[model samples]
Target: MINRTKLCSTVVAVSALLAATTNLDAQKAFNSSDHYLAQPLIKNIYTADPSAHVFKGKIYIYPSHDVEAGVKENDNGDHFDMRDYHILSMSSIPGKVTDHGVALSVKDISWAGRQLWAPDAAYKNGTYYLYFPVKDKQDVFKIGVATSKSPTGPFKAQPKPIEGSFSIDPAVFTDTDGNSYMYFGGIWGGQLQRWSNGKYDENGSKTDLGKADEPALTAKVAKMSKNMLEFDGPVRDVQIVDKEGKPLLTKDHNRRFFEGGWMHKYKGKYYFSYSTGDTHLLAYAIGDNPFGPFTYEGIFMNPVEGWTTHHSIVEFKGKWYIFYHDTQLSGKTHLRNIKVAELKHNADGTISMVETYKK
Candidate 1:
């Protein structure tokens, strides 16, 4: 016969042991600061295309989560194959990166393929909108938006991708007048595709690839609707030209907008920032207006020891930062990790160069 008192005691002891173990696991999961002890803001995972924003009082970063292919059929080390995104945040305290779990994943997006790329977040009207790019079944990359009531979210993506967008690297800029604009594109001439005839088609004409050193098409910018679900107007090519209306270029044959396009408004000036291709240096141009005849400034950061550098600039608590990624942690060209460094703007409105952090 079982003794009731002894059985009750044994049950209580087992319950206590299980609770303790669960608590320890929770602590370990939330201990993200421990992983970010190195210069890279995150560790143990590959992160790329860091798009940062100052929401409420903390700095939130939206970066594409890079996972190396483990399945024998899925191995393609040369190509990018990010499948999800993780939101990382830190308060005023430095060196603390709290992983906000999976904000959105390819599985959540019905129209999207597995190539989940760069993403940016914006808060408006009590809702947070995450603008991201994903490949569709047609093998074309399309930009889409997701929403969440909280900055950190298991975001719900819209049923359809943004109608007029057919490129990658979607960055949104909200002006003081409450108007918003989206800038996005990628390599292979950096042209914006249009949505016509029930499909995304090329814009205007293609660039001459033979003239690689000459300035080709820049990023395409369009006014977004108030809800940010659709485009308000035609997507136009960004004007990167000199006073003579000639397309400008760097000496080494790089387009103004190769992959990443981040816009920042400061002191009534719109800074169009992007990554110059091949060389992989962060550069920018200054424009009086968002869709501007921007004057090329120069490189903001020298090339890191990586093949790519996609980033975003944000100001948190009066200090500015440039969030970017490199291949330091993975020790490979494709698997990158997010990193950040302090940025300074000169009195003339030009930004100072950001050096890679080493600790």
Candidate 2:
């Protein structure tokens, strides 16, 4: 027969050993040494349209997952068909990218069908709101918001899209004075769609090939209300002009606005940057305020292998980085991966040209 006291002691020791092992596994969930070292910040899966935010001292990157075209039975070929987003993060400590997992997927968003494109996130009163664009049941592109308590979240999607906001690439900028602004628009010609005799006009008001005189391909910016759910004021145009106040994209000038409008304030000046559509080069214009008569500064980044170049800029630990995407990974245009590089600004406040990482 066994001693009862000895047996009880043995059982307690085994239980303590098992508990300790479980805690060790939890702490080792992320492999810090295996973190991505160079440009394509993530390697396991494809990510695109990186909207980065500096939250609570860590850099949280919200990017669209590039799902291959033939994933479904009815999948179209060589087209953008993204349906979800994942929140990726890193801290001041090097080589530690935490995969926060799927923050918001199309399945979680009721109104969204397919095409979950570029997204942006903002924090207010302890709640983090994610703003994304999706194709509604009516097949029109609309922007909606999702909220969560954590920066990397299983965010709850709102019931409807933001009223009066249409088009793609929804970016929110919070000013220094606590005032928030939202910038969005796309399809260069669509932005230049004019008002003809009170009706919608499509390039009918063009002079000098709709470039020199008329501000074609201009993005829109508006003030957001306290809740950020609705626009607080009328949307205004972000006019694009050259340093000499001439049209940035004239018949003689090939440079023009395509899509992917992102805004950031550095040294009290607002930098409105975007990707030149079809051409794929990333460029920018600077203004004194969010509502801009921005002067085109020139190309900000060399074009990536992909047809699109959606990006976001953030200052983390006194270092500025530009987060964008490229087609180097999957070797296909639609299947792109997010990348980051040191973003330098000239002494005069203009952005320095960013060289793409080949590897």
Candidate 3:
């Protein structure tokens, strides 16, 4: 039996803690004892693009299942030939983590083409929704959804992809008002650059290379409809701007949206974080609302060991943490592993720059 009252109280405490944060930027780095950063969470199987969430009292991780597929590595992300998803859960951090085995796979998806990229999950009305981005038979990437009664799911697919969904890395964030919005998009092999013209193009637009004058590409976000199966409105671009209120240009590698979009609320502000792929850094922007004209804040995690810098931020048991991936498992980019560490938020709303744990 679960203690609903205790869970509710703990969740409230966590929000209060974040809401009450102050300019504690000088706070020392988290001592090693507080996190499981010394090694990957699961050793038997390779995993990446971890989307960690708190369901009830336990922490549930919805991660893309990385496999040692011999597909050649290329700019188009052909090497990351993942075919399924494995849901993981833990009673508490730095504690026993359980791999719930195969929750969803390519074979089970009739419309799926190949390479199940990053995925995220959400729970509503006693059902768990698994949102994933994958290619179809035409080799065009589109987002899809699956459902299960239990958090560790053997989810049943919806048969067709979400009509207006595209790109990779589907992150669903339910706001305080209970409205759920999804943030998604990525570049390179993820095929976001191909959609620069607002429509899917196999050859990509002529501006795909991104001239110095053009604004850096943007990520896509849309609100979940009442059915939770489709977008509530036309997908919109998540504007990443500068302090002066100008969009970052395409040539700005240091601060731009490359891939891996995640949204989290802290002190009533929305933080939109992503990977700066070419630079291998995880940066973020802040805005007043879910669909934002977010101003670029700064990088949170420095360049990681892996070629990719994908992550998720979550508040678990009164503390905040980052769930990210690295290529340390096999020293190969495609064969990556998931890791976690304490993420500090200053009272001034600035995030402390985090260096990847070397141990």
Q: Among all windows of ten consecutive residues in candidate 3, which has the lowest summed lDDT?
A: 22-31
lDDT of 2 by residue, 87-175 (tens): 99988534577788888988888887777888999998889999998877755567899999999998999998987776678899999
Candidate 1: where is the Cα deviation over 4 Å? 1-38, 70-78, 189-208, 213-215, 243-245, 249-255, 357-359
TM-score of each: 0.81, 0.80, 0.88
Clashes of each: 1, 0, 3
User: Candidate 3: which pairs clash?
Assistant: 22-347, 23-347, 76-189
**Residue-wise C-alpha lDDT for candidate 1, range 1-359, written one tens digit per residue:** 54555644554465356435533443443344343323678786789899998888888889988887653321122267788888999886365799988889899999987678889888889999999888887657888999999898989999999987877789999988999999988754233423323355645323223333445656789999998788999988787765466787533334356679999988899999898655567888889998998877788886564567789988888888888876666655567888887789999898987765322
- Tell me how far the alpha carbon of residue 278 in candidate 3 is from the true structure, in angstroms, after superposition: 1.1
Better of 1 and 3 by TM-score: 3
lDDT of each: 0.75, 0.73, 0.84
33, model 2: CA deviation in Å?
19
Candidate 1 residue-pair clash tally: 1
TM-score-sorted candidate list, best first: 3, 1, 2
Q: Quote the RMSD, in angstroms, for model 3.
A: 12.5
